[model samples]
Target: MKFVRTNKDRLVLISVAGEIAPARMRSPYSVTTEGKVKVIPVLGGITYNVRVGDSAYGWEGDHVEPGVSVMARKKEEEIPFMTLPCIGNEVIVMSGDAKGSRGVVTGKHGGVNHVIVHFDDEVLEKLMVGDKVLIKAWGQGMKLLDHPDVKVMNIDPDLFEKIGIVEKDGKLHVPVVAKVPAHLMGSGIGASSSASTDYDIMALDPREVGVEDLRLGDIVAIMDHDNSYGVGKYRKGMISIGIVVHSACVSAGHGPGVVVIMTGEESVLVPEVVERSNISDYLR
Candidate 1:
């Protein structure tokens, strides 16, 4: 594998204003169940006690947590904050009580353009709105030396090493927290590319393999899935690897959100289940 680093002086520093509270759907329309429209917390700020690997707490729309979501200024600036940082990149607080504290970029929540970061419990307590953060942005054009068939997406080279991905018998063996069947995948599929957006886990059953066991930074495998450039479709022998970016949602076809990191056909990829396969564990 090869990674080319960008000029350090040109790296971008983004400033976040605050955490976004739960939003209510303006249209009085209902999809699955309804007392009110699908109301749930979307993005921004510290998620206090929630830890990666914890159940996204499906079905409880009002209280679920979206761990450590941060955003830059609205409009154009939000683009850089969302696109520059890759999974496993380091983030340092520049201005706040948590100034000088460091954290790892875990995932990005699409639509809201929020980047999720993981920090120590102590750091979380110290973080506040309007904190300035600098991202060392280096994971844009990475390549596998031996395998050209496998496509890489939104993953830093250093972080990719920590993911426990190994080469064996001409295929990449990836360690994941859980394996999700393609049938359970919902919203965001076929909507965006693996490079910038994420697909949702339907959360049809709370007891599903990756459903209850999933955490904010866990890496999971989606079987029979193909996301070459974000057009999600089913193809036999294909697998998609992704990072869980948001908490589970109560609405149908919505649950823990996962952004694509790596994908390949059967000839190039294979997924292995490993307990506690989360970003926090890898970084530690």
Candidate 2:
């Protein structure tokens, strides 16, 4: 990986959880395959114990969490939380009981613009929705020096180092839990960029590669996927690296969501499957 300097002005300190809104539904009357109207927590609360790759249960829509869910002050600030903080970025509690405690950016929720951060169990006990957290916020506009064709998206430089990436045979070799095919990519496809949203893993078939085994925080590669400018359009010879953010959903064109971390054209990325590849293993 190569480093490119970005303007310092792009970096900003953002606050968290300005309001504790009630859990929402995309469609209040939506029903699951079981013919039951499913309602589940979506934001602004500490969802205990669940980690990356866990099932989202019967919930429908984005920002579903198995852990703490942190949102920006309001809808206007959603863009910063979604696009600025990269996976593995350091987050510091700025106020409330957990003040001064630190955590790691774990994932980004699609559609709702929520960012999930993980702290130690003890710290979580003291955390509150009104507490403020600060992010260093410096990952946009970075690129690979060796591979110009590859585009880095929403990845902090320091966080990227911890992802266990290496260069071999003139291609970037990334350690990932699973290798996903382009056809399985569901919602959020064709978007202009991945900075603010994520694509879904349409895990309709259990036998598909990496679909059944996906875990939250797992790094996976989408073959033939392109997200040069936040959009997830498909093309030959392109690849996108992402992390599992939310759990699997029963909705059509929806399953586990993977937020784009890094992407590049063919010859820029190659993925190697490692059984234990998960964000928790590295961050925790």
Candidate 3:
């Protein structure tokens, strides 16, 4: 809990199911120097979905190279405060008797901090586990103040009470969920880490993100930010967004819906007739 790195928006980008890299590279045995010194072959380390306490992914082992150090505790800012804004996407029920009861986020398994809310199925049959859920985070990256190209990322402002999309006369309705088209989307924008090494969307299919058309409160949109749709350096014209945290698996090009959240350049905002809200429901 003492990871003081505040920019407000306390970090929440869960993703882990498969695909990892760096598995071999053994080279160590040199001792001949008189004026030159060079040795390189580390090959491992740097798989941070963040895991240390609960275990299952963030233990800090398995890999981590770039200057190799460990004790970590350096953070001068960035923790403005974020307990649940979009702990996966908007939540409620602050105390007992399902205090407020309301949920959405369905995944945050980054090394076991736990955060997978859904509710319904009879309130998840009644709810259990730890039971606390009280998030609001606050209008995640809110935009529209002047249309910047319309870009919202990892939202969780209580998700406009469940989910609502609005665009008016231009087209782009909402409700129903699952769209994953725009050309499959896959490349690498800042490199998301479910575990490590992942970024492929070449022509997906699977009935266009299958699962009867993706559900569990779907919310996806990854229509090219750049890299043509796969190397992720994207930034031109910005518009790469995502949210469908789960549902869709067969592994061809893998598919369990997940992007938790993301935005583009300056944060993205360009409105002329775009008004859909669900950025984690006004940040709990």
Top lDDT prediction, candidate number: 2
What order do candidates take by TM-score, descending?
A: 2, 1, 3
**For candidate 2, lDDT tens digit of each residue in 1-284?**
44333343454544433322234566655454455675554444676667654643334434466566677777787766677777777788888888888877777776666677777789989887667778656677766766667778766666676778887667788888777888888888876558877778876554555467677888888888788775668788888898888877655677787888788866758888888677776674
Candidate 1 per-residue lDDT, tens place, 1-284, comes to: 33222233343444333232233343444444343465344345567766666666643343233557667656666656666678877777887788888887777777566777777889878877667777666565566657766777677667777767777666677888788989888878876556777778876565855467677778889989998776468888899999887777656677788888888896777788887677766764
Q: Going through the candidates in order, what is the number of backbone clashes in each?
A: 2, 11, 50
**How high a TM-score does candidate 3 get?**
0.27
Candidate 2 differs from the real structure by a C-alpha RMSD in angstroms, to one decimal, of 3.6
Kindly give the stretch of ten consecutive residues in candidate 3 with the minimal lDDT sum: 64-73
What is the lDDT for 38 in model 2?
Answer: 58
lDDT of each: 0.69, 0.71, 0.35
| CA displacement after TM-score superposition, residue 41 of candidate 1 (Å) | 4.3
lDDT value, residue 263 of candidate 3: 35
Candidate 2 clash total? 11
Task: List the candidates' TM-scores in order.
Answer: 0.82, 0.84, 0.27
- lDDT for model 1: 0.69
Candidate 3 wrongly placed segments (more than 4 Å): 1-115, 118-133, 144-147, 153-181, 185-238, 250-254, 258-284
